[model samples]
Target: MFRKLIYIVISALLLFSCGGNGDGGKTKLVFKVGKVAGQSGYLAQIVEEFENENPGVDVVLEILPSITDQQHQFYITSLEGGSSDFDVFALDVIWVPEFALAGWLESLEGKFTDEQLANFLPGPLKADTYNGELYAVPWYVDGGVLYYREDLLQKYNVKPPDTFAGLKQAARKIMKGEDNSKLAGFIWQGKQYEGLVCSALEFIEGNCAGILDDGGNPVINSERAIEALAFMKQLIDDGIAPEYVTTTDEEATRHSFGNGNVIFMRNWPYAYNIFNTEGSKVKDKVAVKTMPHFEGCESASTLGGWQLGINKFSKHKDWAWKFIEFMSRYETQKKMALNVGLKPSRKDVYSDEDLVKQQPFMAELLNTLLQAVPRPVSPYYPQISLVLQAKFSEVLSGSSSAEQALNEAQTRLTEIINRRK
Candidate 1:
């Protein structure tokens, strides 16, 4: 069931490579794209077209429902084992350190021409590189966005808040004056997933807490962080945000917001097209803008997206790189962004005539993405995020105080990193 419902389902093929290169060394490239079930359609078609464009290369794209961090753990197990069958990989931005540390990815500095590197956005360029080596190329980008019910806010004579305190006050006012019991004030991804890391990072960066002293060990339990988490908790316990938000991921939160049950939603750009569509109850009433900010910090969003990396064990390094390059092209990115509203990783796509016409939020989306902060880089980031997710989930659910949760998370993360180091 997990195989069928998740992204593109390609069962891990067991292979014992006791042999040498075959057929006069004609490489067979197998591209494994992170699949998200039905969301694999666009990339699948693009892969077919890419294959048609390059005849000699035999390319197979595996769509994995890799949006979840659990899926990342699943693949890391295989890749670390030197699985040659899976050539190209779709990876999360946070995974660069883990993948690069294991030496599972090919260094693309000498691989791709300077002209090609010049075409990518600086955010992805920096994200794909680890230490001093360039590894994966970002395929698509998604940054946090602030979505609100335009009509509802206007009906209450409220304008979109520009700062964190302003937003909380606005949410409180909206909740009390309106039928707030039936409407959540603000909705965020608070569950124990990679998304929680994204949301928490936004809070962290927006609060001026990027003070990692080395080894990327963040001062997560600092006063600013504690205050941010408290504000988040107050939003829930004080009735501005719903209590159920502790368990809600992007889908649940989006579903609630799309039904007009929430006045403000902090989510990725994907929700822009989804929540504003005709089928959604929020149609014509929903609008999006940049995420709000704190006192000193301007509006900051967690900058992250997915990257496509070639496995060092792949039999088709040459062809796989070619396929990676094919997908990384501006044209292909624009098509994917327009097709499913997956924001493009390229800086150039934001101004595309077609894209601008279809998605008017592109301007602010571009700004947010440029300003999006990548999570702290470390080989054990997954472990670090795990500790935070568990504790933050508890904090959101009111099972623990924000200070208690951050302290616990910080302690656990420190232990995990120390043991690894």
Candidate 2:
């Protein structure tokens, strides 16, 4: 009788372990979604809404590190091992090509209708597509823009400069008139990291030069490219930008500008919200414009944002796609924009009357978003970016001329591309 009781007890434990959460014996399908850490409260609300709509589906949020490089490494380690731990995950715009090439992301072709796909901005849509297949859906969009002290410009009777020469002239005039030694004429990301690549690309592409041609061949060593890089270096030597920018990243620049010590800043759209927040020194006194271009060239803003993809090894592929679709929906995107200050990937979201009213800056940024350009779209971009960060740092640090840096970058980038062929 003791042996019989032991068997019954073991069976009861198994039954309880297999049972659902008191839902009339119905099992819940749980999906894990991974994203870089930020805006957790609003995201939790979004997950709750998705859960309510789906009933039997539960979403577990897996927050990754805030640093982009760290998040990339984490995905590499997990996806390389074919881990089915995460059902869906966020992809940096630049990572779509790399991840798609590795077969770590499931192809999203035919998942979105033509009308639905067309609603997305072209730059992000292009980034998420590899070869002829779509591998991810754009969650939000970002582009570099010029943030300036609006009150200062108006106080000095200066117009917003559309050309780099005009910007420098305006900045110098403002700095001299303000007579504050602590004030910087301009600021940007100059640290040897992913942000440096984004900042450099804007200058390079603005001068009608690019790191890679449309065919994915290195073209970063051209005369125009050299001139662009040299001009960036000149900004520091001339004292228009601080020498300490060599160690500055996005947040550092944002803080400097927010403290009201900057005349102009080159940063992403996310800074707009922060600059206007309560207690900010520059509150209600800042405005944005497209980055300035050189003569006979057009302005260029680097494409930067995140996308969503299903893990290729996920067990719940269908539910994963549903979550991605829900996240990419107009309502969801609008909530993100309204609550978290993320720019929407959907073109229609930008024109929504409510969004325009609450965030008028979104309307003003439409042209900049429309003209933004992507960095090199090769699957080996991560490798190429590292070479660029090193060489670009050399130029900025006065250790190498622009010509020397670009030539070295060109050689290293070519070798990386050749390996792919």
Q: Estimated TM-score per prediction?
A: 0.89, 0.93
Clashes of 1: 8
Every candidate's lDDT: 0.79, 0.89
Put down candidate 2 lDDT per residue, 234-282, tens digits, no spaces: 9999999999889999999999999998999999998898888899998
lDDT tens readout by residue for model 1, 1-421: 7757443333222122323343344455777766653467777788778868876765666666656556687677888687887888888888887888888888777777777677777777777788878999888887788998889789878899888888888888877788556788888998878788788777777887752545566578888888888888888878888888877888898899988799999988777777666677877887888888789887778777789888888777878788888888889988988887787888888999999999887987888787776777777777777788887778777888888888877788778867855
Candidate 1 deviant stretches above 4 angstroms: 1-27, 113-118, 211-215
Worst 10 residues of 1 by lDDT: 9-18
Task: Give the Å shift of residue 78 in candidate 2.
Answer: 0.7
Q: In model 2, how large is the Cα lDDT of residue 113?
A: 97
